[model samples]
Target: MSASQAPSQPVPPSWKDLGKAASDILGKDYPIHGSTLEVKTHTPSGVTFRVFGLHDNKSSAITGDLEASWFDRKKGISLTQAWSTANVLRNQIELQNHLAKGLKFELISTLVPEKQAKNALLATTYKAPGLHIRNFVDVFKGPLLTSDAVVGRDGLLLGAETAYDAREKKVARYNLALGFYAPDYAVALHALGNLTTYSASYYHRVNADVEASARATYDSKASSNVNLEVGTKTYLDNAAFVKAKVNNSGILALGYAQALRPGVKATFGLALDTLKLSSGSADASAHKIGASLTFEA
Candidate 1:
């Protein structure tokens, strides 16, 4: 040994150092900070209420919404009303098990009231008796506008769901989606020809408390982008849970949730910017931190 090199001096923890460490681990992806809070309660008479709040760090704004829903078990119907900070009100009704035993069918309708325009969304879901296959149709009415505002036309979104139980406790699923103008539904004969997008996913149980899944999707229109995401969830002791996710773009995120009490919980999340590491730009590494609290009674 040329004289045992002096032990490297330990570096103190600093924001920059932390950023560099995260950059080294994550590679090129960036994260933006956001947070949410939720509270839910049920009255003795069976009425349920929920409130949600969200915060955006970049915008430094907090927005909230509230919803009250009640289910009539005897009638298999649910009614809900939700109001958001944006002055939008949504009234919804859901009917479950609307059909006899031959098939299981559910229908849901939502009406949104706004000063600019009134909108409605209707959806129907059908499931096989044994729950092996499922199908759905959703229709949106009103002035539906895209970013370009060129396709501000009402449309119907049709989809089908099918799953296969693979060997060794693995499962695979496929979802086919199609979108077309509501006026053209009759002319199209509800064809699957205009396949707008489709997604495939596979899930496996790593163990009783852990599961992993991967999903890939492709869009035929709207920029024609393909996305892939892989994630895992682990159930920890004491009503705690953790999740980790990585996207095809190399972004990584970790989330932890802890139950503070029987009806209260807290959650924390961290996302690392892996992309900056690949480009050797640790200074530009963008990491995010978010936290939320939830209560249910």
Candidate 2:
């Protein structure tokens, strides 16, 4: 009788192992898509600082320029939380009396007290109508631990809406952004509108007492092949507070982005973004800001 061979034990797929394997093959494609850094100094303080920049992709952009501050005085508990607000309204005025059509605006807020908000959005508004049969996939790694995979049957879409406050390039003190496109609004509404608090934080960016924030965006015909885009994004560590000493975030930002190509393809806007934090005061607050972008269905 022929000896029967023992069945080989199936190896359970480990996320980290799978990630490494994927990285070995795909080559870190999501986090390293091309991020720019800008210098925004508070002239009054004479403190020259730099902020990590964001990409120009619609469907996967959310919030921008959200930095955490430190509040010395605490009401009761020695809470170390802070917040800031900046109003941005960019219009195509004229450089050398020339007409430019890159009019834009955004408002993003963030803070991390209890920690618990973690997730990254990638790929949006990318496709080649002429080429056809395109595919896009995104994988994210952070505290909350969430994965974003966008499979585009036409081409690839990319986006980045990030505002980072970092004294150093590698480490950002406060990272935030808000992007609005043609596809993410509905998802945000569905996600946020159904929760008891509707405000959920995974890693460090959560909503504590008086925690509330929002984002919006807009985009026009900015691509020849249906306005394709590519960009990258990253988030900082989180320390949030959930239930009774459950350890969670102190602030949180919830929203989505989309894209709408006028008159050509079925005008499909995709959405993907981030979840961050924004502190209010040393105490008695958690989150703030309401933001959204873009103009179209």
Assess every candidate by TM-score: 0.62, 0.16
The C-alpha RMSD of each candidate to the native structure, in angstroms, is 19.3, 24.6
For each candidate in the order shown, give its overall lDDT on alpha carbons. 0.56, 0.23
Candidate 2, run of 10 with poorest lDDT: 185-194
lDDT of 1 by residue, 150-183 (tens): 1112333233433333233332333333333321
- In model 1, what is the error at residue 126, expressed in angstroms? 3.9
lDDT (tens digit, per residue) of candidate 2 on 27-91: 22122222323333333423223243444343344334533222222211111122322333221
Candidate 1: the clashing residue pairs are 26-274, 27-274, 27-275, 28-274, 28-275, 28-276, 29-273, 29-274, 29-275
- Most TM-score-accurate candidate: 1
Top candidate on lDDT is: 1
lDDT of 1: 0.56
TM-score of 1: 0.62
